[model samples]
Target: MNQTIDTILNHRSIRKFKPEPLKQEHLALILDAARSSSTSSYLMAYTMIGVTDPEKKSALASISNQSYIKDNGHFVLFCGDYHRHMLKADEKEKETLAYNVQSTEYFMIATVDATIAAQNMTLAAESLGIGACYIGSIKRDLDLVNDLFQLPEHVVPLFGLALGYPDEQQEIKPKLPKEAVYFENTYKDDEAHMAALDQFDQTIETYYRTRSTNQREDSWTKQMIKTLHNRRNDRLTPFVKEKKFNNR
Candidate 1:
């Protein structure tokens, strides 16, 4: 495989990082790569905040319950932002139908933009031999995160990314087989799909058993089922509404 594809396939979440900081040049390049990602209709609805203050990082770590959030060489919060667009439209005396924070479509576009940008940054970091982990647990306390970042209306912290030099090694996790996820012309949930899922469960179980860290003898299906049974993120809708993203 080519270098790009090889890097993509070898991706792993690095939880433990060395105390060293990233060079300014590398950080700039990574941010540039993130901004190069595709933006929905060029709205570029994503905004990235690099957190460096010790007290702020400590608070964020508490909110995420992940010490790495504070210890990483760099912690970046990615936000789905539409406030900039709205302000620009107002200045131009232009009507913005899509800038309505309550519109689900607009919200989705902003989310897509943020997610794409984050992935681009992830790939760029990995290519530069930097280790990175996506701290999605920040979503557990969306209100606190919003308050900490002073997010205005039409802005939401989607996730935080922790990046630094690796202090530990980890095995690359397995993913479901292509047949189980990819569809051809139409969607199908027949015996073939079931068979692929069953096979993938075994594959996942083996990976968990043999992984270098946090080894557990559980299949992907079982883990997902248990997680789903907990009914997570019940507060997410309310938080969004509180942010005045009232459009459905």
Candidate 2:
């Protein structure tokens, strides 16, 4: 296989990083690779904002609850930038190009495009020895981010990636059994699948018990339950609609 295909298969998220600064050329090259990722309709609807400011990075780190955002040499926020579509419509004298994205297919398309590009960048960084973590918790504090960044209409920050050289090594996280992930032509809800999942849950609990040692939920199922119960911020949909993404 080609080098790019090999890199794609070997991808992993990096959370720990060395403080050494990434060179400007390396930064440009990785970003160029990210931009090379496919975009739906060739709109190039994704935008990555590089953050070099200490305070802003700190704020992002605090929001993400992932300290690596602060420790990394560089922070890059990927966004689903729908504003360009509006600009094009306005300049082309086309009307009815409303930014009403609520429940629209474009919303999902933009999110997918941005996420794909973000992963491409992560792979690019990793291939060059720079570690990185994709931060998703920023959605929790998008209000703080909207005010801080002055985000325009139809533009939403999807996630951020922290970038630096590895200060610490992390093992490859074990994925679910192939049978657990892959399905036949039709989804099979057989007992074998549930059995595999239960086995995997035990495996996850074992890893967490050894790694965390905290008095809390142990299994993957328990963790999923905890997240479902603890996470109450279901406001993102309304917020996105408010931002004119979904017309509702």
Per-candidate TM-scores read: 0.94, 0.89
lDDT of each: 0.87, 0.78
Off by over 4 Å in 1: 91-99
Error of 1 at 11 (Å): 0.2
lDDT of 2 by residue, 1-248 (tens): 98778766666677778787798888998988898899888867777888888888888878878788888878888887777777756543434556244447877878889988988888888788788888888788888777767788778788888889888766556578877888979898899889989998988877776653243447877878889989876867777776667564
Error of 2 at 197 (Å): 0.3
Alpha-carbon RMSD, each predicted model: 1.9, 2.5
Summarize candidate 1's per-residue lDDT along 1-248 as a digit string, tens digits.
89899889999999889998888988999999999999889989889999998898999899878899989889899998877777756544434544355688777888899999999999999999999999889888898888888999778888989999999887878888888999899998888899999999999988888876688889989999999899689888888876656467
How far out, in Å, is residue 81 in model 2? 1.3
Q: Identify the candidate with maximal TM-score.
A: 1
lDDT of 2 at 9: 68
Best by lDDT: 1
